[model samples]
Target: MGASGPAVLIAGPTASGKTALAVGLAAALGGEVINADSMQVYRELSILTARPTAAEMGGVPHHLFGHVAAGELYTVARWLADAEAALADVRARGRRPILVGGTGLYFSALVRGFSTVPAVPDAVRARWRERGAEIGPAGLHAILAERDPAMAARLRPTDPQRLLRALEVLEATGRSLADWQQETTRPLLGAGAWSGIVLTPDRTALRARIARRFAAMAAAGGLEEAARLDALGLDPVLPSMRAIGVPEMIAAARGDRSADDAVAAAITATRQYAKRQETWFRNQFSDWFRVDPLAGEGAALATALGHFGAGAGGAAG
Candidate 1:
């Protein structure tokens, strides 16, 4: 909370203590915490998503957590609009807006603005899907390299979804995804109006924390939550259904796998997801403030406060 009114963004990999740090900062700076994590939006997923407990919020106001139904599709565009409104409301009340989460795309959309690419035609999409099914992702990626080298270079050959998207965008609009991205619209937080910090903790310690957190989730009725969500018969492709632990837990709940095996698989998947998040922040947010959680939580918050020029304050509303 710079006197000039800059929102604070706390981003990092999962199990890196981002939630604790964000809540502490919000309380100290008279700010409200806004969810930037895409997974945390689904109303049905509190435990598996690692959403903050009521007690853990520490009396600070929080927005956008567990607000969307698991059956609905929540996209980045919708999140940006919601976040803009949240920031406006928070600022109007004379409190800082602290956007915190592990999702890089949300932060990127906020700071760099959204790409206004046209929707791919359903026929074009279907064609690409059929091509992908016939030729496989690697082969499609090769075609993408020829049509959109810049986008292809950034995407993994094994990532069929992105590969298809890139190819479809090129075919439909005659523009690469990267090209569209370069022509961004107005960012929600304009230049110098926001500060961001990405927590960089030791990989080993983060993995261990992920394991412990998953175990805690199991003990905290995560299995029951998964059972309830699975019973809804939501589309497996939906973000909520693919949440880190939901699929594995659902498998166990359905007797497709043992509970112990599901837990282990979920823990492993979480670690893998954390690793991807870490890499993304490292690559995309190299200029943002970076602090090691192992160094200490207070130190990390102090660094953020220093960056934002926020003074000590009363409890957040």
Candidate 2:
């Protein structure tokens, strides 16, 4: 953004300690933190999403965190607009902006730009979820393959939500999802705009951490929270509504699974998400600096902090 702009960013899958790393880097670099996350924006879902706590924030200001109400679905375009404003403020105050989050799409939008992926109306989401129940996730995949075979070719066969969105976009706009995607041209960072890195912790360690975090969540009242949300009867397809553990916990609350079984399922789902995150950063951002969390992360991040003045390369997360 400026000659002296804060160039540091920390990103990784959930429970990889990206928040802790960001807070530490901000303290080290005289910077502030800006969220590049999706669910972390919603105030109501903070605890479930593992949002940075006041204690975790440690007096360093956090932007775009817990500012949105649960009901309002904020899109990536809105996130970019909001982040630009935050970056301006941070730079004005002579503070570096450290973007951190688990949402790869948000970070991708911050770097590679995104199109107006229409916010699927609640009715639209409901219809798809209902169809999914009747015909299964594979059914949604087939529907999308028929409408936008190109996009389908790139996605998992059972990614019901994405398949549904592609079909919805084609039906509603008379254009394929790939066409809108092709229109995406904004390099999110605006050409040499900011220095960034993805923290990819080891898979063995990441899976262990995910299991431990879910175990801790269970002990700390995840079940209770799930019970509370279950009473609301929100559609299962809403982004936050379908957070990693929600479905498992819901089934447990409904007596379809034991608490132990639910925890296992949630842990399994989180591990799956982490694997996707790993593959995403590895393939999509092969050029971006990476700091693996298991190794010399502190020094590696400090090196990344100098990216604005002097670019740094990979360091194990």
Candidate 3:
């Protein structure tokens, strides 16, 4: 394997078989897997987040999975820094780095650079968090609408975390988050440094897969994971808590909702999230090679390997 050769990026929506494809490519190419999923970073909810199991890892070394505590706020900047280190480490060891996950922002930052948003002071963050708790997501969004309508219009009112972030940036830097986003640093992987693929499965088939996978998760300790996370009593607005299924599962575990109802809600949420992920990939990664992993992991792997073997350049499907 060439140490300086292009790193392979496998991105897809949930339940698209990204893990299997990545592990297969790693095994075939003398590579290692680096996580790019935001939810999979938490050490506390592996089952709920569907962090790949030990058996699923297929003896390939995986980096940055389940490494952070549930209570901490894990930012894109933090993930970018960790991914940079992981990439460098894998390359230094003469192994290919295969970054696989559904998080489009992570891939975008690595490939197209990230804006350096000024850090919020602890006091300023606390003040906004307090306001959020009192007024809720809609309230925070309304405040942002008043202060920075451009950023607010770009964000969903239901997303309290991002709304809070926008407010904090305005409070701390006296500038809108939109203004800060225009000042991006150099990309971690510039053109020709990495080859990427987006796994785009058929929507109907993907929805079925999402349903089946979540049902399997429910039967396989997902409730237990959610219960444990709830026991930690973390803030509801934290990213870990806001993971697709955690809140529903926690409700189920606490007897606030029946198990079946919780599972149904989670499945629905997961499908919705998958749709958003697909849209993001389609729009943002238009240049990357595309593969439908629903065709079978072997076929997907073969297609990706062929792309890589062909110098892994240009857009292809």
Off by over 4 Å in 1: 1-4, 120-153, 157-164, 167-175, 306-317
Better of 2 and 3 by lDDT: 3
- Top candidate on TM-score is 3
Supply candidate 2's per-residue lDDT for 34: 94
- Report RMSD (Å) for each prediction in the order shown: 4.2, 3.2, 1.5
lDDT of 1 at 7: 81
lDDT winner between candidates 1 and 2: 1
Give candidate 1's whole-model lDDT. 0.85
lDDT of 3 at 205: 97
- lDDT per residue (tens digit) for residues 1-317 in model 2: 55445356567888887887788778877889999888888776665678788999999999999898655657778888998899888888888778898777777777677876655566765676688778877877887777678888977876666676777777667788888887774755665556667887778887898998899888878887778777776656666677788789878988899999999999999889888888887787676666776666476556555653364322211
What RMSD does model 2 have?
3.2
Candidate 3 is scored at a TM of: 0.97
Q: Order of candidates by lDDT, top first? A: 3, 1, 2
